[model samples]
Target: MRDFPSRRRGWWARQTPRRRVFFLALGTLTVLIAVGVGAGVGVQRRKDNGPAYLVDPTTPSGPPPDAYPPNPSPNGTVWQPQANSTWQIVLGSPITIASTATSTVPDVDMFDIDLFGNSASTIATLHKLNKKVICYFSAGSYEPKRPDSGDFKKSDMGKELAGWPGEYWLDVRSSNVRDIMLKRLQLAQRKGCDGVDPDNMDGYANDNGLSLTSDDSIAFMTYLSSAATSLSLAIGLKNSLDIIPEVVNMTHFAVNEQCVQYNECKTYTPYLDADKPIFHIEYPSNSPQLSAGDVSNSCNTRVDPVSYGAGGGTGTLSTLLKKMNLDGWVQYCDGKSSTTPTES
Candidate 1:
């Protein structure tokens, strides 16, 4: 996850402001890796914790939690998180979550997407089909391409994001960072997302440079979840298996990637115990855009060939046989397929 965020930052940062805002807004679930983190490692600190908040998973927003956190969310969107829902996570470039195709991917649940990449009209399209929408965001780390990058203070940053060139780590402790995130959530409401997916929330799992502890991530998630709930926006946990037991109650679903490949799917089963969906993905085809052979072997549970392109091919299909961009094109176990790209 850290690698995905670290490497891709350069690709994102160098883009024009419009494109940068668009990509980061999409909340592409990139961990610190090659393409997204092109800049040096970035680490930032937290301050005074965060605003206090509260929500009833079964109830839409009403009031903010008393004490600690500030009043209302950044934008005052009221949302509630829930369960047994289905989902898809594709944050890479160009994945279209806002298509007008009346048809669905066929099966399971809801759709999670880049908050920026998806538009208000796209959300309306999904609602027409009775599906809930989850907006994605980076609750951790600093991406050079984000609209709020300039909002981050050098004093609040630390480390080189390693493989990423244009990016660096962010101090989660910064008041500036929290404020920016609050604004992003507000936009989710303006865009009409039912829930929110904040990626890279696990600072405890990487070379984050902030000397960030699991406790730090836990506190942060608690803060974010509570705030999201207050806005009536359902909230979820993205791939922080270590803290699931502690934060599960705060989240409505578990958004995960590569859980099958890492042999760690069991860690998220608790979400199932809680009757929540663990949105799982494995790069069976190296990239989502699988070569026929790659798709055949990987999908069949045959041997994993080293030559099989890893991340690139998986991006195209692993989620819905659509690319990392999450376009409407999708294929399933029965060899079914479809394509529908969203238009803003």
Candidate 2:
């Protein structure tokens, strides 16, 4: 989701040696807290006769096979992103991924962009540059502007997404919808995408006319997981916190928006515990040039380690400061900003 726009302020970079040391120390402290709290919670749950929620760290590598369909077929190696991997997302414009000797986007590890708009050659170019491409698509909603919009059954369409004209939520329970999403996944595979970022997943939380519930989300995510895994394409849950406990094992990572502003970063650390990344974005509605306070509030938002930390406090995050439109412009925690070259 795009964030509300903040007014432009005097933006500046914070690359001082002292600030670097502070961030380094904060990272170490967060790790310690996470470890200590994790053990304590595990023990307490056992003592309190509560459900054992923590998965055994040594159980196996990758997501649980049970989350996928039976007898799934694999195509090739799935690109898994680390929690610390830096990224840039340009959904509003199809930016140039492959750089010439004269120009290039910032040297980030991954580039997330519109799936339907991007060309296979663009994805191939990113791969040639040793970069991972996460294709973005609307899995839970129907956009009338899409090329395949006519394929959606009339009965499967629900209420329009508020503020987004011509976009409506899809009934996740429909097999027809699933079939369309599978085609989208196939397209992503053909385009050579490393992973898929399916958006508008939290339709149940909205005033969706479909009477959809969290269970529907879980079922849909499961089906998507099975399809993605079978195609050897990694899939991420986009901003659906309620389904994390039920579907985190199936998800490769998370695409989160404004968790710090909403005071919900703690809920998403399950990805970190599962050794997956949370690609986070925050739109400072107050100013494009965020003040020091804005930076600290966004970057240092305390993540609780009760379910997920070592010293008993906030966890570090990989965050981006961007505008509401989600254009090519991006700013890191270090305060540097740049615009990726977008196609007109």
Candidate 3:
């Protein structure tokens, strides 16, 4: 996966010695907040054990269950993609389909594109081509340029995302932030998206100033899944493998980046164990120059068979080779390559 913007040290290293002293003082505040939120949840757990962190026991318990409706209608009918569905993602730019009447390239089942970058017409056009759409948006960070940027209160913002500019980690516990995300889901619902690719769900794993815990991330995702399901839009957990066991049931699928590079693909098999998809992407070292070995390594599934052999070995994953920018250029495991048309 592309390194997250704002390298935790890159930013600090760029600073002069005097400036480093200044930020270290600020980092102390972050430490205090992290300690106050309760420590020990940061340790990564083995796939067999699931996440070391569980939901905070002190959280208020809501009302008990009402029987699920036989045909519980969310805002619309939810469509869950298959575990092995082939897909393409183009988040860097808006795609210019060759023809509005029919798709001419990439015989993939689904297309994941940025929510705000493309319009409802783009989604409608994809529908005509029999392709499913997964709308992507930052669910755990505040992007300053989004139309709803103003919706985030100052208090809701936290440390700048490592390596990313104008983006800040959000306090997922904030009701206001949750409300804004609900509105984004509404937009997805209106645009006829089949599912949502919520990015930055792993803020707790970062040096976020808000002291967000795994419980907080779990709570946020739980709320997002329920909200998306209520809207008839499928929600996929994005890259927060640490809490997969806690939330596998809540999400319809998973979108992973650079799992092979980090050697953590095995940790995400819980999704496949439950018959959910893991849509994986790997940014090749050489853009457009992917070798056969790149394909083999990226597509390899290495998991402990003893722990997860419930008819589902390791996990089901669909790998896509993409440039770090994630434009239209793509290569499959077969080494076949194609570049979708993009507007100049």
Candidate 4:
């Protein structure tokens, strides 16, 4: 989500010199107005949730060893998603799954939703309709609103994310953090999730304020992949492009965002080459009322002879045109749009 709040402007919007200067002046004015109003502009507030508690108390704590065993995959029986698999991701809220319904509104093969927001019953309902459930969570950031937010130690946090308030980059190397993430993984397994989509794994690529490196991300993926494989849950590599070659073999699929807009879709072709689905998302300007030019640009762009996988071939992406907030509304390359019913 471009490391920002859901409603914030896209990075591409500020690339022009005119917009950059305008935003700079606007930012200065906003800061000045905040100071005049005696408001805490950049401070992060932690929720009063009594005390830090583990999400999955039965799961063991502590970080895994530096070098762990290889993931039991490709040979092991895990749910491996194929290329060009149709899907929908709605993190803005939980989707409403009717028990008696024969299929979802979009009738996609997969549904990726917030891990904490969804219940096991919801996942089971999706399963009844023969849809795979991919639970979504942030593995490399501390979000204060999460149920297990208090579980994170103060020392385990770095600087706040630039545009996302109350969210801070996490020290992925910390045992406490890894322990918390392990519990999250266990929660996903317990919730009957077919797979887990762990976001913010690319903290090393941002101004994380923690001296995070690409090597640390690679190691973190290793740790997560081992735990997920053990739980018989498929895990996806989320936007850690720099370490794709290292971790692609371990991960079952790729959950990517803005690859097409950033002209980096080719970077994720490794997953396609491995016969893994690249569940891609693109947030076009003025979405929910997308222009024809915008739709054409998003769906018809070819990187290395690969399109959005309408034909389902090697180097193609299973792309979905979505709003930045990732609500139920979704548009496909075939010019079909549908809104999966979500809980209010």
Candidate 5:
């Protein structure tokens, strides 16, 4: 065998240089192909397990160390909405209001629309009509369709929000996440929004895989409230009923949904006591064609002890009856309904 190896070496030394070079190149390519296949298998294994970020708890998992300061004096520069203020929220699509139009359909004190869907001119038009504008955005969730969605790192996301596709619960403690929200608040400021309706602030109350707690939500709200105040924008506490007592003083109002259906309307009476408006919404089964029962259930739901007494009187709830999609169609407690025109 030793003699055979020596003979093979001698034969290779005598071969043409081109042939030797070709064999060496072929050997390198074979090794490279093997390595590539092994790497691909490793990646596939990781994918099968889950995203690498999900497995690695590299980011901080709990509320930040610095506790949100005690609720400071109310910012007089920001809008302080009163209790029982009239409003309409059209988040299904952008409302269409012409510059020459005299007034918006279903004229209310304020209009809540999607922050990214509407333009500065639309806000200006609403301003000309003497109506306040509340820009809406998701603060505690990762929405893939948002313009800044790509800014979110995989490490900052957790479980997908139930019943909402392509929307995931965000790690509220992530500094990167808070930075993106600050930018969103800046956008609202530039767009002339009188207030902001930051939705999905109750991630801790859901099955968020990030182990978020009420403290985390409270800290996140503190950050949001501070940022919005600095930008001279009013912020609303959206559906975070568990943390309402902690954050209601910092927020300007409450943008609640389905509180009546969930029998949690009483939880929001704090806003009423603080003279803050509860911009409540209830999604009935047949909206725009609401039955008397639907109207009664939504518009007549008792929220407080005094106004909504045993007689089922209209309370401080800035109530609106609409479809689940939250389109322009709005029905009031007085059995009046109107559809605000929207852009296709």
Candidate 6:
């Protein structure tokens, strides 16, 4: 299994044969596979978990006074995933969210993607298909390879992201930072995304070296919310459990990484209670022990239990064990797997 990560690394290295295609795949946490174990499962909006968060903007008062896009949609307001909204997130690379992904799970809701990697036409394609698009960008950390990486001032950078080498903590407080982020939002708008998913906002919880405060994070989120609003796009507060109450109103949805694993799903309820969707992802405990029963959830399944086992895992994961490239490979919590690949 030691050779597995290296083997996967080779895949990306070879991907640049035509053009240097840097990839950012989610790291597999082999340790957590056993966590979910025999926990009984089913797709749910979390029943009466003590009145979830107030996420719905159109309260009994009838949609907040905030200005929204002029709706010309035949269906009225654009697509926003509610409790039962089916969704998928793949940041590893560009995905044909509209024609390809939508064509397959056209019935599902919401497709969160890397904002920088995807092109404007790609986003336009999704909008043409009448699908809600979520543009993803690293809010706290700055990847050195991004198109606008050079735009980030060295003074704005802090320390190397503890584990990620080419990345570093960003001073979310700087006006320069705001400018770069605003540019990203503008890109999202030009691309036609329905929303934005600014990741790594939980810098306050990490050794960001930026001395970032919860208030700072909140302020940054507020800025992002305002930017999204200007573009008529919804924005999500990505995995900052501590500030949920503070920033909940500013953002439209919540994109949680591992709520159950972190025992913080409750903190995310505020968004859910408000009728927003909590896009979740859990890792497989054992890379090699994938059972046929793992299909219960969209995540927490084995790659090839027979060859990999309960712990030994390999290959690029798609969506749900989808693929390293995040194609159509889906591994549900029940261990059921399928790769409905689109034409490359």
Question: In candidate 5, which residue pairs clash?
Answer: none
TM-score of each: 0.64, 0.74, 0.76, 0.76, 0.75, 0.65
- Candidate 4's TM-score reads 0.76
* Order of candidate numbers by lDDT, starting with the best: 5, 4, 3, 2, 6, 1
CA lDDT scores, all candidates in order: 0.63, 0.82, 0.83, 0.84, 0.85, 0.65
Judged by lDDT, which candidate is best? 5
User: Candidates 1 and 4: which is better by TM-score?
Assistant: 4
Q: What are the per-residue Cα lDDT tens digits for candidate 4 across 1-344?
A: 25664337768563789888888999999999878654332121112321223222442452235334434334456698877799999999898977898879798999999999999999999989899999999999999999999999999999999899999999999999999998898798878889999999999999999899999999999999988988788999998889998998999999888887888887776676677888889999889898777788887535543453333447568888999899999999887899999999
Query: Residues 1-344, candidate 2, lDDT per residue (tens digit)?
Result: 77533423222243467877888899999999999999897787556642354344554353454454433224466767887688999999787754343324777889998999999988878877778999999999999988899999999999999999999999999999998999899888888888999998999999999999999999999999988987888899999899888998898889889998898988877776666788899988764777877766777646646545433333356788888888888888887778887888
Residue-by-residue lDDT tens digits, candidate 1, 103-123: 555533577778877678877
What would the per-residue lDDT of candidate 5 be over residues 50-83, giving only the tens digit for each residue? Answer: 4444334453343233334223224437888877
Residues 1-344, candidate 6: write the lDDT tens digits: 25666577785565654454223322233334444442222112123221222223334333333444433323334345565465666676576544444463433456777887777777676666666778888989889888999998999988888878989889999999998898788777767778888989888889878788899999989888876676677888888889998987777777765554455555555554555566766554543345554434434323332343233322212224343345555555435554432436
| Alpha-carbon deviation at 341 in model 1, angstroms | 1.2
| Candidate with the larger TM-score of 4 and 6 | 4
**Error of model 4, residue 120, in angstroms:** 0.4
The TM-score of predicted model 1 comes to 0.64
lDDT of 4 at 273: 67
